[model samples]
Target: MTTSEDTLESHEVGLAAPPGEPLQTLTAAEADGLELVHQWFPAPLTVRDGSFALPPEPAWRAVVHAARRHLEAMVGAVGRLECPELGPLTQCGSAWLIRPDVAVTNRHTILSLLDDVQRGARTLRVNLSAEADGSAVLHCPVTRVLYIDPIHDLAFLRVKQRGAPQVGLVVVDSIVTANPVAVIGFPSHAEGGYAEPEYQQIFGDGWFDREGRGFKRISLGRLVSTSDTLLEHDCTTLGGSSGGVIVDLVRGSVIGLNFGESRDRRVNLGVPGWVVQQRLAQLEGSI
Candidate 1:
């Protein structure tokens, strides 16, 4: 809730949440709750970039706890193949789900699994864990798949899992010049994944135009260079967070999908929400 314009790295060092809480799983009931909460706000929350600046000790611990709790309900939606059985594999370099009810992730994540399958990997498995404790659950079947951009690497999957809580879909919205934004996802390095969020204020906010909406990456710092981008405090994202929601906190809506980060490891790039809308619409049509 703090607002600042500083880019500081907030490290998440802690234990993960357990996966036993039925309430943590995405469900219709939870979706209703989110809708109710959205109605209370006039606009979605806009995210900006800045360090969370934990006050040291337990407070930082609380932050880490919150992040782990969030991840507990998230399930990894992986690709499957039948030629050979390689058992279940994790998107070791990807993030968890944005909404638990429906497991969504960067299309490339699933694609990567497919790549492995073509290379003689067997059985694509979706990773699901309990929300209360980080208990590992086996193969959560994927019932549906929705891709926003065949080329852009965005996809949403309808998975079948027991005890998932009701979840509301985060819809993308129209863009405005210099709008505020926030991202909620698990990021990580090649070494491993982190449960914390990677928050970056679009120093300047922009969106994907209709023609250019396919698969594109927008640089957060570049926006700041072009226009005004509002940022928030203490948000840092790591690996294993692909396909998480980049929300308009002020507007209470989603603005983009977390795809990748900067090479220097500073700015975070997000795919605009409008593009997500287009892809979702395509999904609905195909369905």
Candidate 2:
């Protein structure tokens, strides 16, 4: 296995992965597989700020062109949930439109938002996409909390939409190791007082705004493992990455929903696509 202390250490100090466990390393085969994937897909890209840096690779360009419309306005930053106790916007996860009027995020994220609402805070907003200069294009409000999955860390929210395109979905029974994938979301510095240097090291300096908030970022990585309910990938993510979509680069379909990461294993965890699809069907039937 090849260890990149720099990469591992960066995530350790950030909220994505706590610092207690030892740093994780990639095996030789996994490292080579990622390099191969990047040859076709290129590296991660920030929506507004790094727009100019997009590579000329034909495959990457084609994928971006095909997926742009569905993703650009559909995936968004779940705004900070209001909490009187915290005295600030508490949760800042990511959410994406599964239907024009419905969105999905982590159950924990919805719980935090609901707790704040129960405490008398009203209005839940989702900043949808940004302009060329990094200004938000829309601030859509959540009209209702549709469903919170009891068995998984998933939740559904109904949002008022102004024609935002929903994502394409695919249910896969099994995922092969080293399958290329991309995670799209807004990754921000975790709320704690972690040093700026460490945060910069993990998230990089370009994806942030003047206020140090994160912009939309697409991180490319490979599938590490999978199970009946979970899909694990090596895609880079931070504190605010919860609820981002895990997209299959080859198929151009959403295969998972990111929720958390394991510090000991060094892989991001997500709700499998099949699980999500089943739940969505159940929700639709119930409604």
Candidate 3:
């Protein structure tokens, strides 16, 4: 057995194992064999100031590939609909399921979808993709609003995705300045509906979706400013990424939620995980 100690040593040296075979999609059993699902450690990997200086190309690439692959099932998209019968009119934003039956997103996204509603109501269909290859798309309709905070533009939606496992949520408290972090989201420009992770073809590092299904956008940058107001960064988020999660790949926990970007689109912002915890508490009573 290649114990966790070996894996840790590999991680430290920036060695990346391809969760079993490197043929693209790894079966659940194969993924399990490689301990991709079980391995979550706090390493020194970070992207300071919206740029990735983490080097040793092959090692970082392998590291990034593993990170995004493992989290594929938990990350998803938030589609907008004026009428369910009409299908989706537009891709409202991005979101992730914190709980099996509950999802968190920006209130602005909820409102934006509601704004175009002509009569009765608007709907948010939680779209989850299975694996990085985009084989399966699981649909969970968000029926009711469980919580809402106007100031932070955060809201919790009730989604009952039939078989989704209840995922544990993690938050980082003590802020580390200028640490390289990853912002996982589905940017509108990237067309977060496809999963073409071939950006590796051009850029030696970063993984992006191409003409494939599911828009899982993983961008590398550093935690620019850990403010009480917002965890700002150069993570380069967009209109479709309003409710995406900002995770500390190093710490293996969520640091914040992607909300908006600067007027120049250079600086992206998110609500700190601390505030995320407080808001999440509001849902506990109702859940």
Which is the leading candidate under TM-score? Answer: 2
lDDT of each: 0.36, 0.60, 0.52
For each predicted model, how many residue pairs clash, with residues at least 3 apart or on different chains?
Answer: 59, 0, 9
Alpha-carbon shift of residue 225 in model 2 (angstroms): 0.3
Write the residue-wise lDDT of candidate 2 on 154-229 in tens digits: 7887777656443433445455554467787766645333445544444544655554445677766677777666
Better by TM-score, candidate 3 or 2: 2
Off by over 4 Å in 2: 1-43, 49-52, 55-91, 118-120, 130-132, 163-178, 190-202
Question: Candidate 2, TM-score vs. the true structure?
Answer: 0.70
TM-scores, all candidates, are 0.48, 0.70, 0.63
Q: List the pairs of residues colliding in candidate 3.
A: 46-180, 47-180, 47-181, 47-222, 192-215, 194-212, 195-212, 195-213, 196-210
RMSD of 3: 15.6
lDDT tens readout by residue for model 1, 208-232: 1122111111111112111112111
State how far residue 19 of model 1 sits from its true place (Å).
43
lDDT string for model 3 (214-266, tens) is 25555555554555666666554434556777877556577887776543323
Candidate 1 lDDT score relative to the true structure = 0.36
